[model samples]
Target: MMPKFTHIENDRAKMVDISGKGEVVREATAAGKIFLRPETLKAIREGTVMKGNVLATARVAATLAVKNTASIIPMCHPIPISSISVDFTDCEGYIEAVVVVKMTGRTGVEMEALTGVSVALLTVWDMVKSAEKDAAGQYPVTAITDIRVVEKKKGK
Candidate 1:
């Protein structure tokens, strides 16, 4: 019971203590999409985005985000991540990012996976915003959507 309520102490917030929990293989996959104009997508496909290779930069960003999730999101434990895979798909008017994080720890890595996808999509938006902007200098068609943990597994 106390372990279940570890995050709360004296009406204030606290990090949960997983000191006694057994370590197991944990894996999580998360995905998200970023919508943009057709022209922007074309530029990305052609490797002509002003900021250089969009997918490559986004992949680096996703890996970094996966490694540093605990720093970005408070209350997350700084576990040793063993593997990270970042994949991207270019679709009509959208680009999708899928991130997988694996670790041997007491807690699952769903949060790290989700954070990687979010940052990857955001990095894509950053790299392509110039191309996505309209005459008014506003990103009318640009948006990030459907960020979620697609799968999570433990001890496998």
Candidate 2:
């Protein structure tokens, strides 16, 4: 049987209690991809997106998102993040955002890492919307996908 949700009690939402848990070194990594036109990828690589540096802006957004995950997520614990790394890679017709978050706290940083990648990809999409839009001002081939946690570790 599936366990009850950790953030629910008496049909009301609540934060998980981690007061009794010991602090440990925790790390998590997440990745996501955004598909776009080949021309758009070239533009991003050449720094000609008309919106300034897309990768740098996305990195900043991802770092901020990782640090603020607890505030944005309803049931997440406010962990002290020790390190965060955000990077982007250009695939054949897509861009991949990878995020890693490390912390020494009672709980893991999986949510933070995932949030980092999500916001990073969203930032990229925002910066390249004009380039990816079709003649009808609609997005045809542009999309965000394959968002998942790639790694998680906990130890002393």
Candidate 3:
């Protein structure tokens, strides 16, 4: 059978009901890459991105986003997240950020993991926009890719 609340029969957007569902420990992991120009990467490595630590700021932002995921996404339950961890690694021409969110609730925390990765990537873009601006002065594009739930263990 199709999942409930995934569609609107006529114009009503129904939220998923979790009143009878058992609370299970769920975890999700999402990852994204920020491809930057050589110079942009150098600036980040040398600690000169908009006068602050880009990676550190992004990590914090990702954690905050995890906590507020329910508020930003309509119809998602406000799960009590137990932990959120954000990490990044330098990958030649790109920076890869991964966010892991953990929670015990009736609903999954996939959105939280996704939101964390997205916000972290955005934060990196914002901090390096000035350095990576195109000839037309437009902000450099940051793409969010490879977002997925790496693992989830259902409670018995």
Candidate 4:
């Protein structure tokens, strides 16, 4: 029979204990999209977004976000991240950003990867919004449509 659900002895919320789990290397990749106006897209492509580098700033922000993921998410266990890569692609009317996080530790780095992508996108939006805001003074809409782990491998 499958095990039945049981509450923790003293806590009201359920939590997973990783103390007994074997340490293993794990990695996760997450991606997100940012839709923008034609002019905004051109500015980014032409290297003229407020005289700032959108992709470069986003990349740095993503790396920092990955390292601080645990502080932002309550249940995430702080893990030592080995490397992080952020990529940006220009899609005619939109921009796609991808963040891949790698770690050699006991816990998976899925949250870190996701957090990186999210914060990076937000930073991009902030940098361009001043020029991309609509006539009504509302910022261009940004969305994080999908976030998922694309790959995983168990360490030997």
Top candidate on lDDT is 2
| Model 3 worst lDDT run, 10 consecutive residues | 139-148
Candidate 4: tens digits of C-alpha lDDT, residues 1-156: 998868657766544688888888787888888888888888998999984999899999999999999899988899989889999889867888888888787788889999998998888888898887778988655444555566656575
C-alpha TM-scores of all predictions: 0.91, 0.93, 0.87, 0.85
For each candidate in the order shown, give its overall lDDT on alpha carbons.
0.93, 0.94, 0.85, 0.84
Supply the TM-score for candidate 2.
Answer: 0.93
In candidate 4, which residue ranges exceed 4 Å CA deviation? 1-15, 140-144
What's the C-alpha lDDT at position 44 in model 1? 87
Tens-place lDDT digits, model 1, residues 46-145:
9998999999999999999999999999999899999999999988889899999999999889999999999999999999888888899998999999
Best by TM-score: 2
List runs of model 1 lying over 4 Å from the truth.
1-11
The TM-score between candidate 4 and the true structure equals: 0.85
When sorted by lDDT, best at the front, the candidate numbers are 2, 1, 3, 4
Q: What clash pairs does model 3 have?
A: none
Clashing pairs in 2: none
lDDT score, candidate 3: 0.85
